[model samples]
Target: MTETRHPMTGNEMSPESAGGMERHAYDVVVVGAGGAGLRAAIAAHDAGARVAVVCKSLLGKAHTVMAEGGIAAAMGNRWPEDNWEVHFRDTMRGGKMLNHWRMAQLHAQQAPERVMELEDWGALFDRTDDGLISQRDFGGHRYARLAHVGDRTGLEMIRTLQQRTVQLGIDVFMELTVTDLFQDDGRISGAFGYWRETGRFVLFEAPAVILATGGIGKSFKVTSNSWEYTGDGHALALRAGASLINMEFVQFHPTGMVWPPSVKGLLVTESVRGDGGVLKNSEGTRFMFDYIPDFFRAETADTEEEADRWYDDKKNNRRPPELLPRDEVARAINSEIKAGRGTPHGGIYLDIASRRTPEFIRKRLPSMYHQFKELADVDITAEPMEIGPTCHYVMGGVEVDPDTQESAVTGLYAVGECSGGMHGSNRLGGNSLGDLLVFGKLAGEAATAYATGLGRARPAVAEDDLRAASHSAVAPFEVEGGDNPYAIQSDLQQSMNDLVGIIRTAGELERSLVEIEALKERARSMAVEGHRQYNPGWHLALDLRNMLLVSESIARAALAREESRGGHTRDDFPQTDHEVWGRKNLVVSLDAAGTGVELSERPLPEMPDELKKYFDEPRKES
Candidate 1:
């Protein structure tokens, strides 16, 4: 194969490109440099395959770094009874049993080993008294199962993975956003993207592509996600003929800063509650006990006394109502606010000050301490935090094979928050981190095998496709006197937040679809000012397409699933229909005309008797 080296930039040029654009060739290309992307790259390299990791932001700055709750793994360090089977059960039940059984099974069985691997690679987690890795309690698990470093577990995990990636000489393309995926026939051939800083086009010619881009929380008006979570990977996969599953189930985290306009939607980690904080209403009443759902009643404590005691004696007492799954807690908080019992800022209070000592709070929750002190000027050790629900995680993404993390489209893989079905309807706290590591490794190795299996017969990206992608990427700059991308984005966010948020109705979902259609029309005429060189306006314009497509998917899927379950709560349906909705998973793909979204249903994969017995057996309290 002959390649030309560009004059100014040291990038290779593909012979098919008449316009000598920057190009790279690798066995596997991994998009999004978060935990899953980094882990995938490492795994691919270990399998003796050339790998490239592409990121939308600077290295080590993906949303994975914002994960403060910890990595969930049944290490059994805190409670000797904890194991993968218990974890598997907790995960399935927490997700409202909508999870892909095999994915959940694989995650539960491999998470502990992944955590140990991270530790072996230089992650310094908090230690137990016996010199073992200490574990902390999170929402759904029976035992203390999260391995963490205070409130900075994600930071440590990213640091370790980033270091390992660098040490192994895996190539990483930072600040490059993939706009489209190239497919030769029905198989992935390459990826097309541009550098964020310079706006120069770049292409990765590879037989396999792994999408690890995180969630789509930014589509909402109030979200804990950063600017980069615009559903890029989800849209790319859908446009490439890969179906998305469970798009309706979007997690609204119960605790996000609701005071001070500037930091309203910032995340307040679940670690606060796991470490002994409690939720209270404006009347200073511990209100979580009153809102416990019937589904979790048997395992959850009914009274504050038992709930408080369970923190110390997990073997004898039930878990606290405050530690219920996120969907339950978020809905409960919303109920309090709607019932006129909320604080002045339209949120309830999360108080750790009254429950734990100041020293302990600072040590276990240093980030929360500083985040509150610096952002809100409310010392978390002395005063309660005013927080409300914020759009957090998306439990929906590209449909992929549970064993390999490969999508329906050949040679295309997805993992992390971009891949669906691991968390069913709602995700348990701390599972995100573990999901990243476990599936990332699986996808990386599988993509490598697929790439290497082709031997000398690799697919090539076409010149006409490259030209079309380039024209599309630069179209916003050509429009004059058109709609502002920022204004359209803001309107889209408002529409989603009001019509398709934590609670939804058929009427609202229908209205949202209508609004989204109008927004798509406006997005077509979106114009950006100035050249693409480091222009934020142009970037936002490009990202709007992805956000709109994903938002529509969520609205359409939510409208079809006329039942309340986990993250996809329908106020109209009001109850979970375990018979119909529970048995089928909603899928979203481009219509036959390749214009609008088409929604369909597929039966949930049956779990074999051997694995199904875990759920049927008696609940193990210990």
Candidate 2:
């Protein structure tokens, strides 16, 4: 509530003697300015709460802006028969039914209205011939269900949300990274972070804090994620006493650019296939047909002719196997590369230019046309793209109550990719955008209601706790000699990539645990040079803690879930054990001593008979 001078610079800032933080007070504090954070802030403000959104990056640079696919919503625009019930079935089956049925139902039921809300707030979606929002085809969905822009849906979505937040007068704190969440009497009250530019500490005092800080993809070497995807929220939630569920389920998207080393792991949107792209091996074979699993056989096309025809007549013919869920596609690609059926690079070929008209290709996927033409010498309208599987998303995150999106920690709510349960073992394409909108709104409203009920009584921050957090943050700079932070980070990435990647074995996972322990030790002793002002090394040092903790949790959880399911593939245990594992959720939490992670089993809630009835009946067709 008061401002003072920095200790070293004597510049006007929060004083060092009293925690040295520029304190801010809000009813709801939302972290990360991505789709979820922005949406949450908007919802909170609309619900009559004082709201603020904080992020470590500039407003538009969040990972959500890099999204290429559309927002999945069963709006019945392209397919009038498409409805929420059908959407719910697709989502549950796509998730392999590992989701909290209530969460999946809420998302499916609310996503349509959320998308329409974006339109009402000024998002100009691509339209159909009848002037309705045009929906496109995506894997695992029965209807053409994704409402997108021309390969830039994320850009448009972020732009709209950002505009809405600004128009509603929500405060934004850009380039600030929170290191620890503060609790008072077992309730989440505030957070401790510092400015990315100056490294001066900042404190946010709020009744509710929304953890929308996204996922942990940066821990993998070949990932489509940006630098900010360090699992900050996941680690913060764990440290603040919230459990993580399904930590082993990390999604490896099948179509990532693989030609040039520089562009490796860059995402190739699913919209390419939605608009009629095909996958091929060096032998000119549509390999997806051979890789189709028995689970999806009834719904997928068996031949290339039928697959091609289904694109035009989806109602009568089954969809292509290329439209199978991401886990299946990624595994198929990995197998092809391992079996020597890959292209010149260690990836397979995705040929769209050979099939679609150049004009249509340019219109439907403008960004892809440019990205391929500029990055690689190949023209997407005339040549195939070198594509492979890449680490894209983690379906695991802070476990929350399905109804409120509130974590076990009373005032700490999580949504978007940072919150678990909505997308079970693996997420379907286009679902991420919809998930953000639906849950972000719910979390925002819930957090607001909780904050309002708390009244004018502010949660107190202990001086000892603030001092300890401050000391720990600055300790890296004090060490005279230690391991380099960047080296440790790079090593952690390689470890996850090689050992805990798409295909895993018992031996490999065991080795990964040993390696992760060493990495954590190195991170703990890592030192940084230079004063705190805009120092990349110091920033890396702070981020290392969260990354290591999250990586360790992922490896530990992966090792324990000994079954091959959606994204967590176990070579030794090659089948999904529904009898045992399916009935339980692998919950990850800090040990009572806060010294290490503890894994436990909790029974998954049974789906209500009313909702279960939909799945037992014949698949819904409009």
Candidate 3:
């Protein structure tokens, strides 16, 4: 016997038509209007489902706009020999063999289609002599493979997707923040949140929800992440009965702006390096050659002459050491600064002017030139930019089924930076935007099929749960006087920065866990002065809870791993324990009471001989 969908007041109805607190009825509610969310909503809509897109900021101001490097795809536009197999090999190697084999395969196979689709939908990319999409060199790729638009690739991508979303008539609820997910009887029902500008409560009754809320980088004091990245999606998934995997893997991008204290964490696009920028220490040495790791030694050049030759004839020459994956490069820069070879601002120098012509630098990296010139008083066309590491992205997120992108919770899906199991322990450069398109489409299609299959059956929202959620949201404002939310937030960021930064120690991680507990208490006692309407204080107060919880998750997972792997480096245990930690992944989920997170170790899913044979080939030169 088949159970039919329960009849409800929220079927194909507008907010005004729906009764009592029900804002709208959507078959799918896609949170975050960034690359992943927009792509998901578009896919769901194309699948004949009504979709609603909830964005915390304005439509165009999503953090995806900050992505400057090109999107990675083996289109073979530049290097005719490049293909999906080579791309897969590069991805697997870049992740240090910790990536889920199936996801990497799928991403490589499907990426070309997605990039071409973007072009079909009015995305104007840089072009080649033959008029095909132009691809360029990036870290961890075997060939010139990132399709871009100078340094504004992200801007063009977002514009194209946004235009497509509007063209399809997808309902976009801008300036909204989804703080809590509503579930009933072991299934997800809908979500509850508030408008950022008006602060009025909003409810969406949907059978399926996709979380694409980016990363947790803002937890650190120095980060390239924006204010919205406070781990909302990661925490919401944990509390909603979905486990998180690889929570310890946080990528510190190697070349963020390090001068002008006001702009210390701003990202310096990898495009500069892709266009022939070189890194040098204050001693006027090209120090990258001295820092190449053994993993990449076979592929990297041993001399400056060979490296420079590779720039013109890559097929015959080796790759420069500066093109190593982010993890190696970031650690190298950190080493240089610690060894007292750093600039006055504690960063090494990236010199493009000395290597490339002024016209070429300005033409290829307009944003980089202007950013350094305007922000740090450095003319990038004539001088070098001081650069260092900064918290960039988290490779760990909600654990989802590789094929469907569905979480453990029924009716819940995740993709992009908030979902795990794509890049593994470390992400390769230019892979993030590619990940967004490939998995975002899958999550959306899967959620729509799951919802449409329900045939109108909806999960009932329990009154007790709704009341508790409402109270928790309003508690801070009702307290009148208590701990200031901003202060607690600042303290949390500082603790995470000092105790659990790029290079960690056992004692520091233990201390971070302790400080996280104290910050949790501070979060509970948080007080907001203004009304909910346009109240940044109240918003921070709410976001503080998510950040505190996610920070503790990262620290605890880092401690449990007991070995350095990818982005997680421990001074006490500096070696990579491939036999132990490499075979296992740390999973984090809520306890039965939904009050705390619990950790467990699980072996990764296996790859069969047929698929595993891909690795049998000699590793490509990256």
Kindly report which residue stretches of model 1 are placed more than 4 angstroms away from their true locations once superposed: 1-19
Candidate 2 lDDT tens digits, 1-622: 6866434323343344366467767799999999999998999999999888999899888899767879999999988888898889889888888988898899889999999999999999999999999999998888899999999999999999998887876788888999999999989889889999988888788879999999999999999999999999999999999999989999999999997999899999999988999999999998899998988888888988888888766755488988899999999989999999999988999999887999999999999999999999889998899999999999999999998899999899999999999888989999899999999999999999999888878687788988999999999988878999999999999999999999999899989889988988877788899998989889989888888888988999999998988899999999999999888889999888675688998898899999998879875322
Error of 1 at 530 (Å): 1.3
Alpha-carbon local distance difference test for all models: 0.93, 0.89, 0.88
Taking all chains together, each candidate's TM-score versus the true structure is: 0.98, 0.97, 0.96
Across 341-400, the per-residue lDDT of candidate 3 in tens digits comes to: 999989999999988999998889998888888898999988899999999999999999
Scored by TM-score, the top model is 1
Task: Give candidate 1's whole-model lDDT.
Answer: 0.93
Model 1, 334-355: lDDT tens per residue? 9999999999989999999998
Better of 2 and 3 by lDDT: 2
lDDT of 2: 0.89
Error of 1 at 205 (Å): 0.5
Off by over 4 Å in 2: 1-20, 620-622
Q: What is the C-alpha RMSD of each candidate to the true structure, in Å?
A: 1.8, 2.6, 3.8
Candidate 1 weakest ten by summed lDDT: 5-14
